[model samples]
Target: MIVSTNDGQFDQLIDDLSRLPTYTIGRATTNSIVVANGKISGQHARLIQCTPTCFIFEDLSSKNGSFVNEVRIARKVVDKQDTLRLADTTFDIDTLLALLKAEPVKAEKPVPPVSITPKLLSEVESNSLNFTEEFADLKQVYEQYPKLRKDCRNREKMIRTGSVILSSIVSISAVVSTGGAALPLLHVLSGAGLSVLIPTLCSTLLSTEEKLEVIDKEYRERYRCPNPACRDPFGTREWELLAQQKTCRRCQAIWVQ
Candidate 1:
């Protein structure tokens, strides 16, 4: 059996769950199934396979909690037929199994060994030009960070605005439904509950933090040393300074044409 989700990073990975009787699911990389969504807790949930087909799913007191087929569950018996949800990501267990079973396995092609030879002058220059091009690409990706950050902020702002508008409408509807017959205290409490609860729930359900994380991950992947051998991550370092240096510190690769 395999455990997987239709979430980022883990989408293409097919990790066998039968290898371990128990498996953890969370945002942390150390988890058996890492889910990078913002709504997922670092140690969100655990799955235990008691038998070949029987499994137990338990929530680790996560903020959002776990749901099986749309019903919130603290602990429940689940199998391949059941669908599991963690935060915004949902996993169709049966679909995953079917996908894996239907996939055709391809045999690995063996690579032939290449004979070592001295680098020619033209080859050396060609590599330098390639590195320069790669460096320029990295700079372009680095420049996109500011816009990505702004987009994340804008999305969060939109969600907040929508939540407020929706919550206000729900509160007004609740109070109007009372037809002014209820006590003043009852009206105040009901309105407060509707407004606060609706917005809070909406905010939790539609968070932009996951999108921000994905942007950061992609930036780090793209903004790195041009040298393939030493792809050292220059975390949040100034791109202008890197360009001025003209060479990679780790690999001493030329970053200029």
Candidate 2:
């Protein structure tokens, strides 16, 4: 789709311009939208089989606006032989024809399709099954790591603490100035310092929580049962099983160990 607008009027005219191509520009062709001199040059110009289709142009709200048949059109499509006026300048219909005729004609070519055989289809199906099994195994590993959820929560808490501190300082300063207090400048400085300190404490606490979460995630991902029968990594309590339990979550088979 092609859209055009004046220097500062694109936003206001975009909706109208969007609806034009759907109605005028037919399917089965490649289209070009041209914007020139702060107005639609050709809004719905299509290349059908490499041949030019009907050219459509419209005006966007402009200081030096568009006029059709000597009538000012803030937004309207123009066809061949349509007189276009911009500001005090006038354009004859033949001028557009000459411009369209100047464009070089383009040749169209046909596209070929490919044929698929049963062997190729079978291989594709086999690869798909292998990918599904690998994905299932990864999902099982991810589900075992509870630290992912904990780390996310801690990061959120840190962001909220920082925002709250900034907001509180701004709010306190506004309230104090509004009261018209005769308090000394030192008092205001102390209040500001206190606000900074509160958020800093909260942020530090959240950061420590996150650091521990990272360590836990790392350890859980690295540790796995060496036993060949139950070599799965433990994650949350839901996935963790007691020692001597004989089920493999990924394969859902009995564990030898």
User: Candidate 1 residues 72-176, lDDT tens each?
Assistant: 998876666679998878986543233221247698899998665566655766665358867776664666466544544454453443344333333323322
lDDT of each: 0.55, 0.36
Task: Please give the TM-score that candidate 1 achieves against the real structure.
Answer: 0.38
Give model 2's TM-score versus the native structure: 0.20
Candidate 2 per-residue lDDT over residues 136-184, each given as its tens digit: 3333344423433343345445344434433433432332221221122
Cα RMSD to the true fold for all candidates: 20.0, 25.8
Candidate 1 runs further than 4 Å off? 1-102, 108-111, 119-130, 153-206
Quote the RMSD, in angstroms, for model 1: 20.0
Per TM-score, the best of the predicted structures is 1
User: Model 1 clash tally?
Assistant: 0
TM-score of each: 0.38, 0.20
